[model samples]
Target: MKIAVIGSKGLPPRQGGIEHYCAEVYPRMVAQGHQVDLFARSSWIHLPWYQSCRFHGVQVISLPCPGKRGLDGLISSSLGAIACLGKRYDIIHFHALGPSLFCWLPRMAASAKVVVSCHGLDWQREKWGNCSSCLIWLGEQVAIRCSDQIIVVSEALVDYFQDTYAVEAINIPNGPASYWQSDPTFSFVKLLGLEPQKYLLFLGRLVPEKCPDLLIQAFQRLTSTGWKLAIVGGQSDAPAYQMNLFKLAAANPNIIFAGELKERYLAEIVRGAGLFILPSNLEGLPLAMLEAMQEGIPVVASDIPPHRQLIGMNRGRLFHAGDLESCIQMIDWAIQHSKEMKKMAQKAQEHVQTWYGWDGITAATLRTYESLLCPPRSKVKPATELIQR
Candidate 1:
């Protein structure tokens, strides 16, 4: 099958979840004998417009885009959709609500089956202005009306679509990134002034919705426990919010802002953590938390629906979302109860390893694509019925 992918920033997955997801899923599809052309942003790739590159057997084609926040996504998606009109693709897949705005272009101009993957409700995010939010909302409506299939990352999102739009979306959760073993010598962590199992880690984009500020404030209120706080991630067009978080941690020398550690450095930091924390108000199955859990690290997260789905049933600890006091209490409890936290970490690691493997996710996604292409003979009969015969 020939597939055209739209809505990711670019290949090597420097930051965003969508890019990482594409990096994992699409290349496996290529290995399975499907050709995938991923349309990316020139701004992200740092390449000239319309330049093409290969990433793990997938063709990544960079398209022109403005450097502005909202405009970049809109312009790149529009151009990607326009490019799809010239190709004879079997599937035209889009990644987020913002890019799904152009899902109609392929359906109108070509004979491709359209698939839209909603990572999250971007309109609900705190960073976007009202105009951008409204545009994202409109894109959601367009995706519902135009796309042949809709894929959501969490059960909460599946319920949201069912209740709000009376539509059923395929529920496919994200798989964890490759698990890494840090150097036993702890060479890199020592340079950062961190010791193994002596620091709390917050790993995600420094955005308002993720609420790194809440973590900083909560950490500040705790009495001296010899546990340093390491905030590890990049800014996502939210420099002001990131700056405010720095200010929140300004008085404390123990608070470390280790900006964007990739590969082995990231692995070492995550593995050395005493506790992993995410105080997010919104999420669509957080990949950071998933990776932490896969590393067998104990997690403390806000009690959002997606978090509950992942960490509920005694898998990990949860605090009330956006409540500073609740966050403080949860962190205190997790720290004090070391043995219990370790037990929960073991359970969480087992759960992720059993259910969230990337190979399974890729195969499930392929089945969805194949089902669309080779649908049952009769609309009233189930596909299973044909298989039974």
Candidate 2:
């Protein structure tokens, strides 16, 4: 089948869950003899060599877009929809609510079946202004009403869509890195003077919704110890909030700011961490949390549904969302109880491996596509069973 993917920043994705998800799932789809064309924003197409337009087996189409924060997706998706109108693709898959705003254009213009993957409720994010949030809400409505099929990354979202819009969506959660381990002798961690299991790690974008400041504040209130707090992501959509996080961390020497780690270093840092913490107030099955759990790192997260779903009672500790006292208590408990945390980490890793495999994600996505293309004759593939809520 011929597929055109939209809504991701680019291929070989360095940032965002949707981009990383596409990077993992599409390659496997291409390997299975499907032709996939990905539309990337021109600003994110950094490599000079990639200007010729191709990555992995997927065709990369770089389109110029507005450099503004919120306008990027709008402009890119608009151009991608225009291009798809002529390309005659079997499926035009849109990722995230922002880009799904344009899903109707292709659905109305072409015979291709339109598919929109709602990674999260973008409107709820604090980074977007009231107008932008309203626009995103409109996007969600369009995605539900216009698309032939809708894929949700979190089960909570399934309940949300049903309750609010009365729309049915297939739940397919995000997958983690398959069996990754950090090298103890990794140069990046060594350069930073970070020892194995001696620091607390927080990985993800620095945004208001993510609540990085909450973690920094909680870390500050904790009694001083040998352990350090390593923040492992760069700013995204919320510069002021990022600045506040940096300012809060600046007051304490124990807090180390390590911006936006990539691949080898990312895994190494996560593997070396004594504990992983995510204080996000909102999430749709965070990939960072999954990645950390897959690395067998014990976690302490905000008590949101998605976090609770991944880090069950047996796996890790959870504190009430946005509650400073609760967060501090959990962090101290996790730090003091080293042996128990390790046991919890092992349980979390086992759970992640059993459920969130990349191969399983790819197969399920393909099944969704096949069912759309061959509705009457398509047989349910056994791989669909792998994605158990």
Candidate 3:
């Protein structure tokens, strides 16, 4: 199958869950005999030594796009959809609901099957302005009515699509990257003066909806001196929000902003943490949470549906979303009962390994692709029926 993937910044996955997801999935998809061409933004294709021509085994097509937050996806996806039409691809998959706003372009101009994967409800995110939110909402509607299939990452999203749009979506949860066992040679952790099981950790984009500020606020109130809070992610088009978090955490020397750490650095950070806290008010199957679970790190997340889904599967702790008091209480309890949390983390590793295997997710994604290309001869099933599998 020839597939053109759009809606992410670029390959090598410098930022965003969707970018990381494609980096993990598409290489394997190419290895499995599918010809995949990933469309990346030109601005992200930086560093003269590092070629943007290709990544892994997949071909990379760089398109000119404004690096502006709101305009980037709209411009890139519009161009990407048109570019895919000329390529005569088998599947033109859009990674987010926002990009699916241009689904009609491919539907009319190309012979390929259109697929839209909703990572999360971007409209509900606190960062976006009113107009952008409305546009995102309209994009969701466009994806539901126009795309051949809708793929979601969590059951919460499946319920949402079914309830609101009366559209059933294929639920393929995000899988963790390669699992790494905790070890003593964590140079990054050591360099940061962090000891294993001695610091609380939070990893994700420093965005408004992620509630990193809330986490910092809760951390400040905690009386415990033994544990420090380490935040391991970069700001995603939200510098002001990031500045606000830094200001909120200014007085507390115990809280360290680790910026962005990739690969083993990221793994070691997760592995060495005493407990991982995701105080996000909104999420659609956070890969960061799954990564923590894979490393046998205990997680205390918000009571949002997606986080609840993860906690339910991994037996981790949860607090009411955006409730400072509740978040403080959960973090305190997890820290106090360290041994119990560690045991839960171990169980979470087992459960996530069993449930969220990357091979299985890749295979399922392939099956979805194949189903669109080759339907049964005897009977034609509805799009919802394809999701049921």
- Reference-based TM-score, model 3: 0.91
Give every collision pair in model 1. none
Candidate 2 residue-wise lDDT, 1-389, digit = tens:
99999898887776778888988889889999999999888878753422536677988888887567888888888888888998899999999998888898988889999999999998998888999999899899889888998888877888898898888788888988543455667668867777778898988888878887888888888874888888888757677778877778777878888897776778888888999999999999998899888888999999999998889777999999999999999999999999999899999988888778888888788888889999997744443485643
> Which stretches of candidate 2 lie above 4 Å from their native place?
46-52, 178-183, 379-384
TM-score-based ranking:
1, 2, 3
Tens-digit lDDT string for candidate 3 (340-365):
88788888888787778767777778
Error of 3 at 182 (Å): 8.5
lDDT of 2: 0.85
Worst 10 residues of 2 by lDDT: 46-55
Which stretches of candidate 3 lie above 4 Å from their native place? Answer: 47-52, 179-183, 377-389
Which model scores highest in lDDT? 1
Model 1 C-alpha lDDT per residue in residues 1-389, reported as the tens digit of each score? 99999999999787788998999999999999999999999999888989899999999998998887888999999999999998899999999999999999998999999999999999999888899999999999999999998988888999999999999888777888884667878788878888788899999888999999999999999864889999998756677887788788889998999998888889999999999999999999899999999999999999999999889999999999999999999999999998999999999998888777777777767777887888883131222221110
Give all TM-scores, in the order shown.
Answer: 0.94, 0.93, 0.91
Computed on alpha carbons, the lDDT of every model, listed in order, comes to 0.89, 0.85, 0.84
